[model samples]
Each structure stands twice: as C-alpha cells, then as structure tokens.
Target: MKENYTILAASHISGVPTESIRAWERRYKALTPQRLQNGRRSYSTEDIEKLSLLNKLTHEGHSIGQIASLSTKNLKNLYQKHSPQRHPLAEDLIKHLHDFDMEKISEIIEESKLTLETRSFVLDFAAPILSEVGILVENEKMTIAQEHIISSILRSHFGTLLQISANLKPQKRFIFTTPEGDFHEFGILLCAALCLSRRIGIHYLGPNLPAHELIMATKMLSPKAIILSVARLPKDLQKVDIPTYLKEVRTHTSASIPIFVGGDGYRPRSSADKGIQFLPTLAEFDKMLENFTK
Candidate 1:
C-alpha cells in the first residue's frame, strides 16, 4: 500500500506553512517528496512525522537546519533516556549531608557500581548534599575548610567519570560555559559527562564567559547547541536589557541552532520568549534532549 500526503495535509499535520515547507525543501534540502503522476508532490507518513517534530522544535526556537539532520529514531531515543526516574538516592544524599555524616556518604559511594549509578549518586545524591553543606556553612554549622574537603571529593568523583566518558566514540561538539560572574561549573561538568556518554563532542568553555565572547565563539564554531549555564542570576537579569541580549544572539546566528539555558538561575518561561529556553535543572534539560536532534 502506498501512503501519500498532499501539501495541505502536510501543512495541517505539521503546523508549518505550505510555502515554508516548499522553501525548506528547495533551500535547505530537508526533505525530498515524490511527485505523483498528476504532478503534485506526495509525502510519505514517515516524512510527515519527521516534519511535524521538526516544525515543533523550530517553532519553539530550534533551527530548521539542525532539525533537518536528525533522524527520527535518534530524536525519540534521546527523549526517552532523559525522562525522570524515582531518584531516592538524591533525597538520601541530601539527608546525610545535612547531618554531616561522612561515614554514610562513604558507604553509599562504595556500594554504587555503575557510571550512571555514580552519576545518580553525584547528581541526585552528592550534588544536593553539597548544597546542604553550603547552607551549613552559611549558618556556621561547618567551617569553610571542611566545606572545601567535601567539595574536593565531589569534584574528584565528577572528574573520574568525565575522564572515562571522554574515551567514547562518535563525538558531537557541545559548548558549555557560565555567563559572566557566574562561576559555577559543577552542574555544567555533570551535564557534559552525560553528553560524553552519548559520544557528544564537548568544548567546555568553563566559567565566566563574556556575552560578546560567547557570540563570537558561536559564530566561529557553529556548534549544534550552545549550553549557557546560569549558576546565579545576574543583577542585569532583573533589568529589561536581558531580553535584548538574547535577541542579539538570535539576530546574529544564521542557523536555527538551539540556545539551552540551564542552572538554578533561570526559571522556565513561556515558549513565546523567542530565542531562549529555560531549563531549571540538568535532569529536565536531559529529558528535553531526548527529542532534540540536528
């Protein structure tokens, strides 16, 4: 049986303009629809679905050029791996840290075997545990030097995983950096480890990148995605000019490349914000990547 879709059918199904669809085919070489004997272009069911997902992501601020390159299977797989799981370890890790129980932390680390297990231990457990340690420091429950001891241990664990994952295959380029004055990189490094497991190439820019440098780097590398880590909300974020900064990057880029904003700083806003997508946590960002491709 032959399945076919007309221009209107494709438009209705994809929520993309028929003319824009045609233009994409012409300019971007996104899809190659067959022409029927009567001279109308006919799309297959697979083509329609791919176009639909592509349209959704692009409309939500991803680039069409990036979408064109992603296979539907990869897109679906990416989303599935990222969906949330019941991470009890995360809760337990926090509890232990609040009590300053070093023995419990050491015990859990010894019992965990897999890399994802370790990742879960660190992200779900250790990271939040560290957060509690910070609170303890603020209240003078723990001294600065003690906090450093725990922090160093967590960094060592993260570094170990990163070193192993770096040896994997089929690397894709990822640009990671914190915005100016936002010196936090722990979360960014964790996210990088996850990307590395999938064999994504990483070009971590570390902390405190100037906005202009970020734009310049984007222009230079033209990476598939630019992950901007906002560890702490800038004072400027409260001002109106933040939107202008976001728009500047959008105007400068020719590709529909996605700009993924993550960290504790930015809250999720409505999709209509134009250029930015706010992801509250690494877990949420990981889930969204399941459907993201290009």
Candidate 2:
C-alpha cells in the first residue's frame, strides 16, 4: 500500500540530481531502489528521505564517499550539528539562558511542552537545546551554573512527562537509569522521554546508582529490559569501570532480560559484549523499540 516514486520524481522531491543519485548508488551503495517489471528503478518514501538527507549533507560539504554509508539517523544528527540555522525556539532559549533569565527560561520550556507533541518536544526541541548548551559551556560562552539551571528545568519537566506517560497502556516496561559516577543524565532522560512517548513504561531510577544496587533492582522488577546511559566519562576508569559493571550486572541478572547501553561513554567492543546490545543513537533506539512492539 506504500507509494513508490520514479527516479525523476525521487530527484524532484529529494533535491538530488538523477546523475548524482545513480553515482552514489553505484559507487557507494547508498540506496538500492526496487526494479519494476520493465526494469525501471522505483524508490520508496524512506529512500527519498534518505536521499534528501544525503543531498543536504553533501551540499554542506560532506564527502558523499565518506558519508554515503552512514545511517540515515546518523546523517540527521550530523545535519543537526552542522546546520547553520538552529531551531528558533532553542535559539531564543539559549539567549535567555545567557541573560540568566530563570523565569523566562521556565516559561519558554512550559510553552514548548504545551505547543509541541511529546516526541517533538523531547527529541527535536529539548535534546538539541541541551546539546547546544553543552557546547556553550565548553566554549565558556555559558557557565556551569547556567548549564545546571537549564538541565534542572528540563529534568523537572521530563519527570512530570514521565508520570503522565506512565499511566498510558504500555507496550513494554524497561528500567531506565545511569550508573554510579556517571552523573550526566540528560542522555538517559531523553531516551526515557522518547520511550514514554511511544507508551513504553519506564521504571526510572535516578542517577548515580551502584552496580550491585542495579542488580538488586533488576532482580526485583524483572523488567522487559534494563537500559543504562553512560554519557559522561568518569574521572577514574578504575573506579567506574564499565566492563566490570556490565559483567557484574550480567552475572547477577537473568539471562532472559536483555541489557541495552547507550550514549558516548561506552564503546562497542571488538567482540560485541554478550547478552548486551549497544544502541548508539536515539533514532536507532526508537527503531529497535518499534521492532520490539511488532
């Protein structure tokens, strides 16, 4: 029942030249369009979106040869990071943050909550703003205190959203939390928000929980899965060893319950960790959740 577009239609919609699309397809295997009975190429809606994203990134100076292989989700994230135009509301919020207008900041966030759908508010609005604020702090354009203030505001709002979503009919329930010493929680908070938006129930245990305590919680809850976000690196790897923590949790918990880890802190091992799946992006996580429900 899905519509298919011809190469010319795909080009018109995606803004990529037919020649370039073919070249990317042949050279980089960027997309494999279906061949109709007459041997004409047919592209689906997803293919068109991917082409559009590729066209945008390529125009922004990315090498097609380099980026053609990246997932559409990664491509979108890259575009978000490199785009010249920031989201208007995010830009306004950032300006207010610089002025330290606490009241105005709260008002803007509350306004966003009311105006945008839960998913858009979290992923498209709140996520980007948090990421931009981190950059501001790194460049010293904003202080740590300002960063914390906005984080606190977003966190409080997310908590309220979580409670509201908890009452929805859940497709699956997962335990969401951050490990000890990984106090940076926005990544997990955003993930939790994304999950909740889809009626996925989250048993959110707040940050800085020790490994053994996580095992105990897992045993008690027996959730569909356990998801941890390790966005911030610990000062001492020896003290907050990810491999050790994962091994401990795996050994103690039931093998039937899968463990998913996300964020920048944990790297995928050369040999993938047993009984664990690493979802590196929010888009990928959402896709996996879709597959789970199906």
Candidate 3:
C-alpha cells in the first residue's frame, strides 16, 4: 500500500508550487490524486515523482499541454535529451534525478566527457553512475522512467562519438544492435562508442531489430562479426528467446560471421546455440575487442 500525501505535502516534497500543481493536474491531467472524505486531493509517491518531472521539463521550456499525454518513460527521456549543464558529484547526480535538476545533471555529464578519454569516460564515469542508478531502480528507490533520462542523455553523447569517428580507418567490421523486443540499446551504444574510439569499423543498427532484418543486414554488409545485444531478457522466452533467435540468425548467415551476445539481461537457456557467444560485461567486451581486432 502507498502513503497518500496532501497537496501541501506533495508540493513541499516535490518543490512544486501548489497552484502550479493544481493547474497542471487540472489542465494537463498530469496527476490524479485521491479525494479525501472532504473531497480534498491527496497524492502518492509516484504522483509526486511524476509531478516533479513535469515541473522540471516545463521549467526547461517544455509546454505542459504538449507533454501532457506522454508516458512516464517518454517524459524522462525528453528531459534527458534537452536538459542543460552543471558539475556535480555522484551523490549529487543521484539526488538530482529525484529533484529533477536537469541543469546540474547535464553539467556533470558534459564535464565528465570533456575531462576524460573515451575509455576512462565510460569505465570511470558512465559505468559507475549507471551502476548506481541501476541498483536504485532495482531497489525501487528510483523510478524506471527517471532512469531512462540518464540513458537518453548518454545515448545522445555516445551517438555523437560514433558519428565523429565514422571516417576513421577501420580495424575490424561489426554490426551492433539489440534483438527484437529488447528496446534497450544503451549498452550497445556505449560499446560502439568504445569501439569507435579505437577506430574499429562499426555499423550500429539501433534497438528493436527483428531476426530477419539482421539476416538481410548481414548478407548485404558482410561485416566481420554480428554483435546482437540481449540487453533485457525477453519477457516471453517462447516468442523472443535469445538463443533461439541467435540460432535462427546463424542459419541465415555464413559460418564466418561470429555472433556475440551481451548486456545485463542476457541469459542463454539450457539448450543454447553453439554459434552465439556471450560476453558478461563491458569489461569483457572491451577485452574481446582488443583481442579480436589486434
């Protein structure tokens, strides 16, 4: 059961103006608080979190009307993409997510990028921050929607890095993408960033790619390897099983193209495909890139 907070309490905790909250609730339908015995409105924790995000985004120039219909995940991702900058500590970063302090959060990300090399940037700052956020999300201390904001910000950053390094000489050819139904592509994007920093030739086909599409891509491109990301284990293994998909992919491509599977949700079933191999973490993936390309 969730605790219900009064309008004043929600406003205090979320740092939102009471009238503004009421206006948003009425106009945007941003939140639907419960009515008390006296017909007074009361909010839940999730309601406050959602309101906080809405307030932050609107403060950054987003129109409440335009964003009114967005899902929580969509809202967070929107905030991340457009948020401005500030330098912050790890603790500050975590706090900012709840506080919805986009400027300070943006600053910390930009500062990390400016100061660190690609590998250090990823291993030192990106990885640690994400690891902390992941734990919080798992523990229910942080909302999944808010975490997507971090992913969106980093995804934009890494995409730029990959693009900038696109003209560099190729060390090896690879195709990076997530399997169908696994909408999570941040893991592969981060990996591609590291790969690009090393001047490796990478063709990144972003998330939600069906197996047939991959087969077509493999045949057309003829890359040295096909790297499929299993970022989030399929909710239904019967329909979207990684190993099954890997085997199906293997049947379409030549035996020459080695298939690599990875990410947090990657769990090969008991009877797995022989061709598809799993790399447990980015550290392991980095080592493989070093070994394979060298």
Against the true structure, what is each candidate's TM-score?
0.56, 0.70, 0.64
**Compared to the true structure, candidate 2 yields what TM-score?**
0.70
Show the colliding residue pairs in model 3.
Answer: 85-107, 86-107
lDDT, candidate 1, 87-158, per-residue tens: 555455545655778898666555553434543664555655566566568668678876776688777776
lDDT by residue for model 2 over 3-72, one digit each (tens)?
Answer: 5888987887677999999999999999999999999999987787799889988888999999998887
Candidate 3: 10-residue stretch with minimal lDDT? 81-90
> How does each model score on lDDT?
0.66, 0.81, 0.75
Clashes of each: 6, 0, 2
Q: Specify the highest-TM-score model's number.
A: 2
lDDT, model 2: 0.81
Runs of candidate 2 exceeding 4 Å displacement: 1-61, 64-86, 165-171, 234-238
Model 3, 1-294: lDDT tens digits are: 235778887776566899998898788888788899999998876676687678788888988899976876677667654544322454567788888789989987777777777876776567656766776687687889889998788878887887876777675778999888887676777788778766678998888888999999999988988887776443655247666678889999999899888865553433446777767567778898889867
Candidate 2 backbone collisions, by pair: none
Ranking by lDDT: 2, 3, 1
lDDT of 1: 0.66
